[model samples]
Target: MQDAKSTRITFLLFPGITQLDFTAPAQALSRMPGAELAGAAASLDPIATDSGFSILPTHDFASCPPADILCIPGGHGVADALGDDATIDFITQQAAGAQWVTSVCTGAFLLGRAGLLDGKRATTHWGYTHLLPLVGAEPTKARVVEDGKIVTCGGVTSGLDFALTLVARLKGDTVAQAIQLAIEYNPAPPFTSGHPDRAPAEVTLGLRTHVYDAAAARMAAALGATT
Candidate 1:
């Protein structure tokens, strides 16, 4: 049975989405005392994720209910999604009524494309934070940045942090803490190079040379074409 005071949390599903970006937060938020989760896509068809698997969406854009919290998750597909009018429109419409508008990873770009991030302080994957300015957003450095009702987080794992933060805000710290304990959301990475700042210079440079430099250029081109 649905809780009478349940908060409707909706996630936008698309091809090439970073599964971790969506799943991490969904895992935490779904355990919230009064949370209801929905994954919406262009259709009810299964949407392919970056992880080489497909997820079936709960609703189509036209059928999805207005969300109390609307979240967009990012991946390589985001560069292409930036150009999809229907996706942007769906985000715009859902955000118009959502109590909280948010995104994980490059999903912030989708919010930016929808004009929701205009003049707002936001953050995304470190590799693409520089491009936030193209969307009229002031780039911020943090795991999660909150600009009033709009919240954005960096990269994939940050979604878990963002979700717990939101749960604390909407429910209570105790409830959020309980959820965290239940999930055993602990982190002990072997490497201290999660962020560019801490990562070895050579490692960062090599990653940029092979991946981010070209990826960011494509993102820039996409944002340029849209804006």
Candidate 2:
């Protein structure tokens, strides 16, 4: 039996999630001491990822306990989730009492749809930041932005940084440092063209044309339903 004082961490699992967004944070949080972890979905069936991967939920929505931290990860399927009342309701209820509400990538969009990010400083994938206003959130360009108990991370790989920061917040600096060392989380990229501002004109144009255009269209529809 778990102690009542143990921190309950819940990650929303849905079809078409960007697996790394959830996995990176979940893995980091699992390393925290006395944190009870669960992946909750509408059902116990396996959840599919945008990358053609699958993960099983530990608990269904009805069986999920209140969460200290509620994480919603983003992916191509967020459009569908935005329109899902059950998923939105679950998030709204859980976030009401959660010590921290969070999301990675476009997962922030779901949080926004739940009406949790209104007036909060939040972020999502770089391509989707422009849509933040649709959900009443102030778009932030940082990799991670935390406004009170609401923490949102930008893009996919940023989840690792966000999780490590959360560990330091929940546990302590030492524990977080140890986990970082254990995971060898250092990065040394050969290219410096990750963000739109820093990327070459052609690369940014390509992304805006192929990626941002589609994402914006989906977000526009999602926001319409939520509003």
Every model's TM-score: 0.98, 0.95
User: Which numbered prediction scores highest in lDDT against the true structure?
Assistant: 1
Residue 9 of model 1, lDDT score: 99
| Cα RMSD for candidates in order | 1.5, 2.2
lDDT tens per residue, model 1, 1-227 = 23469899999999999999999999999998778899999999999998988999999999999999999999999999999999999999999999999999999999999999999999999999999999999999999999999999999999999999999898889888988999998889999999999999999999999999999999999999988
Put down candidate 2 lDDT per residue, 124-199, tens digits, no spaces.
9988888899999999779999999999999988998898899888777988898888888888889989898788
* Top-TM-score structure, candidate number: 1
Clashes of 2: 0
> What TM value does model 1 have?
0.98
Per-residue lDDT, model 2, residue 38, is 96
